[model samples]
Structure formats: structure tokens, C-alpha cells
Target: MRHLFLNGPVQNGPFTFATRPGKAVGIRLAAALNAILGLPPTPHLWNTVTLAGDLRHREADGPTIPRQRFEADLITDKYPPGQFPVGGIMTDTDAEVARLALEMIENNLCAGTLTISRETVPSCRACGHMTGTGSHPCNACGSTDTEDRTGLHLVAELAKDRPVLDRSDIHASHRQQPRHLQNTAGNVAERLILSRTRDHGIDLSPHGLDGLVLDPRVGIHVTVLAAARRHEADTAVMTITENAANHIAAHGQHFREHGGARLQYALHGYLPYDHTASLQPLHEAYRATQAIKESFETWFLPLFSLRTKTATSPEQLPALFKHYMRAHLAQPAEVNAAAFNAVQHAVGAGNVSWITNKQGLANVMAARRAPIPSAAGPAHG
Candidate 1:
């Protein structure tokens, strides 16, 4: 396949989408786009390799469970019972992801783009966590006491041939390129330490960097590529926010591509899901059902965020809901192949204008309602 949309692996923490809809924005956006393209639903990517996860596991006083099982259980609980992701879930710490990360590391090392070198880095005196260079308290244990720790570390030697992120690395068209992000994401040191102190991660033990793990920033990219590789997708488009893309862009410099597959960031914005309450009046006016409201919030707003790129304010909710109502009203009785093809072209071209265009939106809605043709043709047609 040419392009497959995947979420920038979301951090698996103790939060539900019911409580924090914003966190699921990337996942929802990816699902919406992939559905439009008629691709099999991509696995929901998750980031479970955080210090907080380590702490959560340590603090739990129940029957002992493996770290991988612990994270998987937590992720399963995040979704409603039997409402799990259609394509299932893949985490950063999954064996598939670990395998891919190691493969990429070895390849980069062979290509001289990465190296195992002993370097001094600040370490938490209490917990042995890499505190990085800052004098601030350790992120893991929150202790200010630290010491310089030197050991074999995985170091990434960024390419000088091009910026960390460029137009080709983004899923947007040339006219919609994120110039600011392209410039800012490159603002990092020439060399980056890709190894980190974590209880559980893609261990670099094979490379003699025992006890160290690949950084989550880089693992996140691997998570996407692993999924893409499974689907045989040549290009994996990760749905992420501009801020998130900026944060991981540097670390993912070399991890974005593996084998013949490549990864690109599709920048989206924050949605004021908290303010969706304000749409109740409009919902009542349009006689929106519970499912209709969900479609607007979960499906439509996420696509709109792709265009908004900043923040969708509460004040805009009413108008956005009204626009959706109009599109819903315009939904055709039968799916129009020509109109739907045009919408697909727009999506593939990184043009999100059709999201707000009533006719285009209706065409998409109609397509979603249309029955899928069975592999053996309609059973009773």
C-alpha cells in the first residue's frame, strides 16, 4: 500500500477517553482517514515506556505480573469491554516493536549513523535514572541529588544532509507545509543520546548496552513503522499534533524509515472536547441522536483538527456542529462513486478542505453508510 495513517503512539497512562478526549485525537483522526481510504483499520499504537509506568508497576501490591502483561491489561481497560480497537492494539514495548527497534539500531550502526559510545550524563543518585543535563529534580524519583554517570550509550549522529523534518516528511501538501515546525524541530544538538534508563524497554543488551533502553521518542516511531510493515504499507502517516511532532521529530530522525516503509507526521490540533457540551442546543435543534453526536465529536471534529492545527475554540463548536448538521442533512440516499473518489483524492493529497465542504462531507457520510461489497459478491443481491 502507498499510504496508511497511524497515530503517533499515545502514552498509555491512567486516563480514559471519556475523561480526556484530547488524548485520543490522533487515534481517532487516523481511524477516520484510513476508513475513508478503505484500508484495514490500523492497530492502535500506544506508548507504554515511561518512568511513570515503571513506578506504577513497582507500586502495585498485587500478585506479581510481568511488565508487558501489566501494560497490556491497562490498555485493555482503557477501551470499553468488547469495544476494543478493530485492528487490535500494539504498544511501544511490544515484541514486534522491540524487534524492529533493534533492527533499525543495527542498521544505523552499520551505516555509521549511530554508535555505541561511553558518555557522561547526569544521573539520579537515588534511582539511577538518567536526569539528563539539567539541574532540576529527576523526572522519575524527583530527587535533586545527582551524579555524572558514564557508560556505553546509543548515540544518534543526525544527518547533516537535510533538516530533521522537511516537507517530504510531513503529510501535508506544499501549500500547507508547517514551516515553523520544520525549522524548530531541527533545533537540537548534532548528536543525540538515544539510550535511556528505564525499567522496561527495547533493551540494548545485544549491543553491550545492558540495562539501557531505547528512548521512548524513538520507540514511538518504531511502533508506527512496525504496524506499517505488518500492513505492507510503503508510507506510514502518523497523526500527531505540531507540538508532539516537534518533540519526537529529532529523536525519530533515523527511525522514521525501515526496510521500504517510511513514516511522516500528519499535524493536527487540539480539540476543545470539554466545550462540546455547548453543542447541546444545536444538537437539540438538529434532532441529533446519541450516535450522531458521537460521530460529530469523535469523527468530524478530529478531521477538522487536521485543518485547524492550533486549537479549536469552544466558541467555534456551535458553528462547527451546525455545519455538520447541514452535511448530515445532505447525506445522499446512495453513495456517489465520483464524489467519493474526489474526496479520497483530496485526503491523499493532504487537502482537508472537503472536511468542511457540505457536499464533500455528505459524500463521505454516504460512503460510510453504504454497505461493503462482500468478497464473493452480495449474498442475496
Candidate 2:
């Protein structure tokens, strides 16, 4: 396949899709695009490596359960009963992802782009957790006692000749390039430490950094690539918010491409899910069906977020719903091969214009109604 859309691994936090639908925007957007392209549903990716996760695990059951099982259970709980993802779920700490990450790190080290060297960092004396900067107790153990400890770390030297994030790193059209994100992401220290003290993650001990794990920011990229590799896609388009992209772009500089698959971020805006209740009146007015309601909430809104690239206003819901209804009504009885092909091409090119075009939207709606080979199997988690 030419391209596959994947979510920038959603953090495995304590929340359900019903309570926080906004968190699933990336997953919904990717699924919509993949369905449009007639590609099999790709696995929903998750980021299980986090300081918060470590503390939660430590506090619950006192490490009686395996960390991987704990994370998987949390991820499973996010979806409603019997409503898991169609293609399954992949976490950042998946064995395949960890292997691919180590391979990439080794390659970067060999090229002199990354090095394992001694560096001093703040550490919690009681818990041995990296305290990071500023004045604060350790997040893991809530210990005020900390010390500067020198240890081997995986370090990446920022490329002197290039901005940390450029147009090529983004999957949007030239006109929609995230210049602001590029500038801000570039404004970072010349060097970055890519290893962290995490209880559960892609362990760097195999690479000589004992007790350290590959930074989650970088592991997220590898997770996407690993998913793409499973599907043999050349381009892995990750749907992420501009803010999250800025936070992780620098660390993912060298991790974006590996083994012939290149990764790119498709920046999206936050949706006002809290205000979606306001749509109830419109739903009643339109006498919307269950499928129509889902299409509006999960598909159309997420796609619109890409075009907005900022928080989508709740005020726009009525008009957006009207637009979706119009498109749904205009869907041709017979699929338009030419129009459908054009829409697929646009999707692969990261073009959001098609999403707002009446004819293009109609064509997509028609395609969604038609049966495709990839849609034959039962949806998975």
C-alpha cells in the first residue's frame, strides 16, 4: 500500500471512550481514511510507557501482576464491551515494536547520529527514579530526596543542517504545513537524551544502558512504523495534535523512518466533545439514524479537525451536521469510480480539501455504502 494512517499512540490512561471520546479522534480518523482507501483496518496503537503508569502499577497490587498484562487490561477497558478495534490493538511496548526500535537505534548509533555516553541527571534517592528538572518530589515514589547521578544514556545529536521538524515530517498539503509547530519543535537543546528510567518500556539494557528504557516519545514513532511494517505500507501517516507533535518531534527525528517505511505526522485539532450534547436537538430535527449519528460524531468531526488545525468550536456542530446530512443524501446510487479514485488519491496525499467538497463527500459516502474485500472479516481489537 502507498500509505496507512495510524494514531500517534494514545496514552494508556484511566479513561473510557464513553467518557473521553476526544481521545479516540486519531483512531477514528485513521479508521475512516483506511476504510476509504479500501485497506484492511489497521491496529489501534497505544503508548503504555509513562511515569503515571509506573506509579499506578506500583500502587496497585504491589507488582503482583505482570506490567504488560496490566497495560493490556487497561487498554481493553477503554473500549466498550465487545466494541474493540477492528484490526486489533498494538502498544508501544509490543515485542515487535521494541525489536524495531532497537534496530533503528543500532542503525543510528552506527551512523554516528546517536551515542551511548555518561550524563548526569537528577534522580530520586529513595526510589531511583529520574526526577528530571525543577524543584519537585519524585513522581514515582513521592520522594524529596534526590541526587545527581551519572549514567550511560542514549543521546541523539540534533542535526545542525535541518530544522527539527520540516514540511516533509508532516503529512499535510503544502498549504496546510504546520510552520508554527516546526519552529517551536526546532527550538530545543542541541542534544536530547532518548533513554529514561521506566518500569515498563522498551528496555535499553540490551544496548548497554542498564535499567533504562527507550524514551516513550521515540518509542511512539517506532510503534507506528512497526504497525505499518505489518501491513507493508511505505508511508505511515500518524494522526496527532499539533501540541503533541511539538513535544515529541525532536526526539522522533531519527526514528521516523526505518526499513523502507517513512513516518509523517498529520496534525489535527482538538474537538469539543464536551459540547456534543448540543447536537441532540439537531439529531432530533434531522431524525438521524444510529449510523448517521455515528458518522457525524466519529468520522466527519474528526476529518474536520484536520482542516481546522485548532480547537473546533461547538458552535460549528449544527452546520457540520447539516453538511454531513447533505452529503449523505447526495450519495449516488451507483459508486462513481472516477470520483472515488480521486478521493483515494487525495487521502494518500494528505489533502483535506476533499473532505469539505460536496461532490467528494458524496463519493466517499457512496464508497462507504459499497462492499469491499477488506471489509469481509469481523472487527477485532
Instruction: Estimate TM-scores for all models.
Output: 0.96, 0.96
Report the number of clashing residue pairs per model.
0, 4
Q: Estimate the TM-score for candidate 1.
A: 0.96
Model 2, span 151-243: residue lDDT tens: 899999999999998888899889889788889999999999999999999999889988999999999999999999999999999999999
Q: For each candidate in the order shown, give its overall lDDT on alpha carbons.
A: 0.90, 0.90
Off by over 4 Å in 2: 372-381
State the lDDT at 47 in candidate 1: 94
* Model 1 Cα RMSD, 1 decimal: 2.4
Worst 10 residues of 2 by lDDT: 372-381
- The TM-score, computed over Cα atoms with residue i paired to residue i, of candidate 2 is 0.96
The C-alpha RMSD in Å for every predicted model, in order, reads 2.4, 3.8
Write the residue-wise lDDT of candidate 1 on 47-162 in tens digits. Answer: 99999999999888732898999999888888867789989999998889999999999999999999999999999999999998868998898899999988899999999999
Model 2 residue pairs with clashes: 85-380, 86-380, 88-381, 89-381
